[model samples]
Target: MSFLTLLRRVAMTLLFILLPAASGWACTPVFVRGQASTLRLNVGQLTVPADARPGTPLYHKSFAWNRLSDGGEQWIRCADDPHGLSPLLLDSLLSGGVTRPTVYQTNLAGIGVRVSLRAIGGYGCFPDRPTPSPFSQRVDNPAALPRCGVETGLFPPDD
Candidate 1:
């Protein structure tokens, strides 16, 4: 066979053999801190369900930023599911977009609010490999962001 055809065959073989071993997914989590007299964080969109009640999980992708200003930290867990979020997704939510961590302003419920976001870390990358829990029993700084749960070596966050 010609050199070109032989190279093609080898490449294809490597891809098939490596793809499964290299393929892994993860969920990235972001920490959002809001600063405003009355800040409210809304992810995705606001939808009122018929079963809406006090103290119940809203069953929506949105989060409440109102408590952020009270020395509270909010976490946006990343996942392949619709309820999860990522830095790229947050960037797209802005009027233009943000490339790096910067203070941003947006209107919520007709009120101006300022906020900042950072990717704390990622988790659930290797389904087959046993990993540590993302949460810690003791958080040194409740306001500080948490690090990634799983150790992602040589692989980037796909999910």
Candidate 2:
């Protein structure tokens, strides 16, 4: 091969080595469990860019739940772009008129978070009897528990 051809091949090889040829991607499974009952649930997985920096805003189109044993799941998605955080608010309804919130964290790059659910309002009062409750019971808007805030100087694991 000629000298020019050899130098061109070497330059191309170095470019490929330095740049990532494939997209950087990461998937994490977020589990949301009800606080009022024994029913355990897993929220939909989050597929985010692996190199997502701070203050990156992403949207979750829709999140649905599947019936587990006796209880059902009610979920809501909330985002906070100012704080670089996004989490799903989950409520699990069980027999005997019990409801609780379960929060799932998706922005895994930041500091660890503590999630909780609180009752805002409900349609009907708690039942007096211990028999199976009636349908059509609804809870008013539930609020997402406050996050402890992100810790500075924290970075995600390199994979």
Candidate 3:
């Protein structure tokens, strides 16, 4: 082939290789940190409606509790089927001073899988009775509490 023809082909090939990469830059994933906590469960233990195959990884921004100013709490559960966790199980934990626990789980193939539950933030109001400590004492600092953050495999069992 002629040198000019070869040069033209090389330039076209290079453009094709870089076109997709340049376009993808505009569609970057946005991750919101410290936004409202939401439950993320893996596909295991709990039965999926067979229809829920797989979906794209959800991008989270931030997490907020019910009562940020007041005494409120949030939780995250990570497990195979966090959604399947019984209310009683959660109630038992809450009774002990746990609230709004965030749950997360890894995507399991079919049978049992691993899961984790953690408290993200909490707040409490002060007592109205005659006490040495003020109501501010009743409120627990969320930042002081432990943070639960987990990285799980992507949906569809692949990235």
Candidate 2 stretches greater than 4 Å from native: 1-55, 65-71, 74-107, 111-159
Writing each residue's lDDT as its tens digit, candidate 2 over 1-159 gives 999999999999998976684333222423344444232323255455777664343331211122222243333323222222233322233323233111223355552222222222221232222112122323322223311111122233322
For model 1, residues 1-159, the per-residue Cα lDDT tens digits are 999999999999999988887635455455554432433344455454556443223222222333333554343444444355333222332233234222222343212222333223332221222222221122222233322111111111222
- Each prediction's Cα lDDT score? 0.35, 0.32, 0.33
Clashes of each: 1, 0, 30
Q: What is the Cα-based lDDT of residue 121 in candidate 1?
A: 36
Ranking of all predicted structures according to lDDT, beginning with the best and ending with the worst: 1, 3, 2
Give each model a TM-score. 0.25, 0.17, 0.17
Alpha-carbon error at 152 in model 3, in Å?
39
Q: Higher-lDDT candidate among 1 and 2?
A: 1
Q: What is the lDDT of residue 112 in candidate 2?
A: 22
| Native RMSD of candidate 2 (Å) | 23.7
Question: What is candidate 3's lDDT per residue for 28-131, written digit by digit as tens?
Answer: 32221243333443433443455554432232222232323133343332233332211122232222133322222343453221122234423122122222
Q: How accurate locally is residue 102 in candidate 1, as Cα lDDT from 0 to 100?
A: 27
Off by over 4 Å in 3: 17-21, 27-31, 35-159
